[model samples]
Target: MRSLILVTASCSLLAACGNPAEEADDPIVAETPVAPTNAVDGMAGTYEVVMADGTVVSQTLRADGTYSDVAEGEVVETGSWRADGSRLCYDPEGDEPEQCFAGGQIAADGSFQTRDDQGNVVSTVRRIGDENMTTEPTA
Candidate 1:
């Protein structure tokens, strides 16, 4: 009986050690966005993003403050965005993330562009009301 009790106690201890319920998983959480300092945020109020080539693209800024990317004649991509310090940052497609305020571009019309230091526009984001702009911070 003593040996059986010891074995049971050891088994229970081992089972507890190996159990996966120790901690819960963290759900996807988005940070709050910072208001634009200049006219950038104000200008960002629901404007179409015009490429450097002058091709006007359609995107919507939702009342919920999310951003979306619209490919020509394709479906829209919804995303989330927020402020990291003073820089504007966001994640896209609920996947890879980006930021514009940190070195990001708030277009003349309140649209956000993620650009490289060389001024190459890597991504252009328009607020889609429900989706927010995505931000990728560069070095």
Candidate 2:
């Protein structure tokens, strides 16, 4: 009788197991997003920033991933930069944290707005220099 009770309990436990077919039908899967390449080329130039307090600042973004942020003809910050889609991410040196700007709208007259990560317009940064390096003909 003891042997029969032990065998019955083992059979009950075995019956409680999940079905293999059900597990196979409901398999869990995860997917990751892919980032675009060569998205940073469009923003490689100098930008002029007129602050809310009426102070003008110059931010130069180079293609070699380095940037120089100048204020009042003095270099205030130097850092590295990258682009994710239309957004530009800056990683400044020292204790300053990284910030991202997006939603840029450039016009034919070489003017554009630089927006923050929340898609809000932080500053209207103008394109300072000639984007195309063309020399005038000398007579």
Please provide TM-scores, in order, for all candidate models, with all chains considered together. Answer: 0.37, 0.59
Candidate 1: stretches off by over 4 Å: 1-44, 53-55, 84-86, 101-114, 121-139
What lDDT, from 0 to 1, does candidate 2 have? 0.47
Q: Pick the candidate with the highest TM-score.
A: 2
Ten contiguous residues minimizing lDDT sum, candidate 1: 1-10
lDDT of each: 0.36, 0.47
Q: 26-92, model 2: which lDDT tens digit per residue?
A: 5451133233255554445556665444566666666677666667566766777766444566777
Which lDDT value does model 2 have at 89? 64
Candidate 2: residue pairs that collide: none
Candidate 1 local lDDT, 8-73, one digit each (tens): 112211221221232223222123334346322332323344444455444443334454444465
Q: What is the alpha-carbon lDDT for the whole of candidate 1?
A: 0.36
